[model samples]
Target: MFTHRIDSATYLKLLEVQDSEKLFQLIDSSREHLRNWLPWVDKNTTVEDSRQFIQHTLDQFAAGNGFNAGIWYQGALAGVIGFHKIDWQNSTTSIGYWLGEDYTGNGIMQKAVSKCLDYAFLELRLNRVEIRSAIGNVRSRRIPEKLGFTLEGTIRQAEKLVYGYVNHNVYGMLLEEWEAKENSSTYDDETYE
Candidate 1:
């Protein structure tokens, strides 16, 4: 299993079957809040559903497609962040993430995302990474912006949530861009919070 320590109190661990109950509980607790932006929230109605989702992540990892990791903040499940899939032919991948409503305003997602970008560019040696957020999701949009991703474009009707179809703003960062950001950043992990 892949585990990354962001700080003393924050880390990301690969999801496993044993995590179903905790994952489901977190999702259930934040259902209404998550339903606003995520389409899969309602579909995950039980622990079994969460187990299946974790199994799928395992399969994806085995297939070398990508992975989903649970964000553990201060020893609690705070959210999830993952690569949707790796397009090896293009040397790129897109990241998707969601944090429980209670976990908002903590800079957890931002730091987790920054770590993912580091992995993508430094470890995986990927050419590009992308993040797409619904137009109305200001919080989600800010993550990539704060991380220095360039606004690529908008895809109309990119995703359908509970409300209706929503436009997506695509943000991308190339390997060179990430390297530049890393070399120039004055803020360390300790000060990021």
Candidate 2:
């Protein structure tokens, strides 16, 4: 996987042990914010927990299933974004992302996801990309919408969160849709950069 850089910010590679401490600190500090939507936070109580997650991600990438990347904004470890899994037979993948509370509203995630879409369609040659956001998570769902993904449908009670089952709005974009967006007269050149 290549470092997806946008202007001065770089989405750095996440690896086992290498970034476990910083990753754990960010998770610990933002436990309240992240745990609200993410179910894995409570399980990530120690640096060893993060190392385990990183190791899984590393093995996932090595197996060509997918990979995760740390969003490095300016000079700090801000958050993470990556493909959840690559369904090669279907030529499809699902994207998941989260930014540290402090990094939200800075257009960092929007750019990071756009670049991920480009890599999925252009580099990986995947036909379809999906982003499923828990219903009412307006901020998290907006990235796919802003990128022109079609509102596929809602997967009611799709996820069993810590609280209860949460509905998910599934957003999808095909390679054709992405290409059309790329060739549109009003296309923003910076989007896929």
Task: Please identify model 1 stretches exceeding 4 Å from their true place.
Answer: 186-193
* Per-model TM-score versus the true fold: 0.96, 0.92
The root-mean-square deviation over C-alpha atoms between each candidate and the true structure, in angstroms, is 1.9, 2.9
lDDT per residue as tens, model 2, 7-62: 56656555546889999999999998888799898999999999999889999988
Cα-lDDT of candidate 1: 0.92
Clashing pairs in 1: none
Candidates in order have lDDT scores of: 0.92, 0.85
Displacement of residue 180 (Cα, Å) in model 2 is: 1.7
- The residue pairs that clash in candidate 2, if any, are none
Superposed Cα RMSD, model 1: 1.9
Angstrom error of the Cα, residue 71, model 2: value is 0.7
- Index of the highest-lDDT prediction: 1
